[model samples]
Target: MIRKLAIIGVGLIGGSMARALREEGVVQEIVGCGRSKPNLERAVELGVIDHYTHDIGEAVRGADLIVLAVPLGAMEATFRAMQDHLADDAVITDVGSVKGSVVEDAVKVFGEAPAFLVPGHPIAGTERSGVEASFPELFRNRRVILTPLDNTDPQALQKVEQAWRHCGADLSYMAVAHHDEVLAATSHLPHMLAYSLVDSLARMKENDEIFRYAAGGFRDFTRIASSNPVMWRDICLANREALGGMLKRFADELHGMADALEKDDAEGLLEIFERAKAARDRYIDGVE
Candidate 1:
């Protein structure tokens, strides 16, 4: 069990994790650190964190596990702030969507990637933000991917894995580069498309009429557009290379689809749709 848990960004992911650990009785104390005092106070009032601090050094001073749940862009600064205050035996992990960027940040801050840092990403969340949206069940049955460096301490990695397991997460491991590429294709690309689609629609002359008559499918497809803009902005910039490659491939496919439509190639369109449907169906079946 963790003697003390420190979460740097006590918003949705961090707060939910604390609640889950508390529910499982795996953590003795959870102290949150964030810029917003009101939000931190709310986290305390909700019992998601036992205490809150605005200072990073104070938050992580004696913590057994430190979770950096801040945005990808903030990883470097957070690491720099807590490097000196962290206990030598404390296990550190992050929830950043872009593992490559996070690892880079660690390397820059510590002069090399620390052996105790285990880069992780939980493949679950709603399009919600802040501590108020957090819940203990957010990670139940979800996958948590850990991208440990070559020098990562085995004990540190195991502790992180066990903690996620206590929260009902299925654990998996990947190389840092592979993890970034996979997340870029599966998560980042989709969010980018969702936001682009919604923005495009909203900017049209008939935007009001279009939204007024929109159907459930439109809402479902653009639901991720409601996610926190700042977080996604950081993710996009952090994984720009991989995400850009995916975007280019998607753009080419869209052009092909458009070509098929313009040529009245019903067979080509049907084939594309059928393949996509089959792939999605298989994925759904496997996950469900």
Candidate 2:
């Protein structure tokens, strides 16, 4: 049981976890820390957490469980800020999307603390950010992937797993390196395409009313592009190697698509379409 839980960052993911942990009765006290006092107050008003403060040290000093819910970009700074205050037995984790950089940062900052676990929870998030956007069920029924490195303590890892499971998430494990590579292919690349496509459309938005006529497909594809810029920017830079590789592959495929159109290669087009359709079907089936 978590006697005291400190969540650093009062945004959607952090606030949501605070809400769930409080409701589930896993933690006796829930404290929130953030740069914005209004956001911290909002979380308190929403009853997402039991307490709040802007002092990272005060919030995490005696916490048995500390979660850094800030953007991936702010992770290292938060670690440095809270490191001196973290309890010796406390298990620290974050909800960052990218794992490799997170684990590396944790090792650099918390090297002396063998009980630390820099586990990540990549529950599919909404484009919505900030405290008001959080809901207790955001993590429910979501796939929370935890990337545990080799030096991570098993007990610490299992405690974090229990926390996520208590929040109604399905747990899965992967190496941080492997997780970044896979996400670069699945999540990262799709987000890049979404951003680029949406940016192109935005440039043309002033010229014509294309958005007014766009269908459900366009909305679905552009939804991720609407995500908070700073967060996505951090993710892109943090996992640039894999994302760059994926981008190259995407560009090559784009040229292939252009060629398929120019050559009127119906056989090639049909084959590509069939393969993509089959892949989507498989993914849908798995979810079902």
The candidate that wins on TM-score is 1
Give the Å shift of residue 217 in candidate 1: 0.6
TM-score of each: 0.98, 0.95
lDDT of model 2 at residue 55?
88
lDDT of model 2, residue 99: 87
Cα displacement (angstroms), candidate 2, residue 224, comes to 0.8
**In candidate 2, what are the lDDT values of residues 82-113, reduced to their tens digit?**
87877888888888888888876766786743
> Candidate 2: deviation at residue 261, Å?
0.6
- lDDT values of the candidates? 0.94, 0.85
- Which tens-of-lDDT digit does each residue in 95-202 have in candidate 1? 999999998899999999999999999998899989999999999999999999999999999999999999999999999899989989888999999999999989
Candidate 1, residue 44: how far the Cα is off, in Å: 0.8
Identify the runs in model 1 with alpha carbons over 4 angstroms from their true place.
285-288
Error of 2 at 19 (Å): 1.2
- lDDT, residue 106, model 1: 90
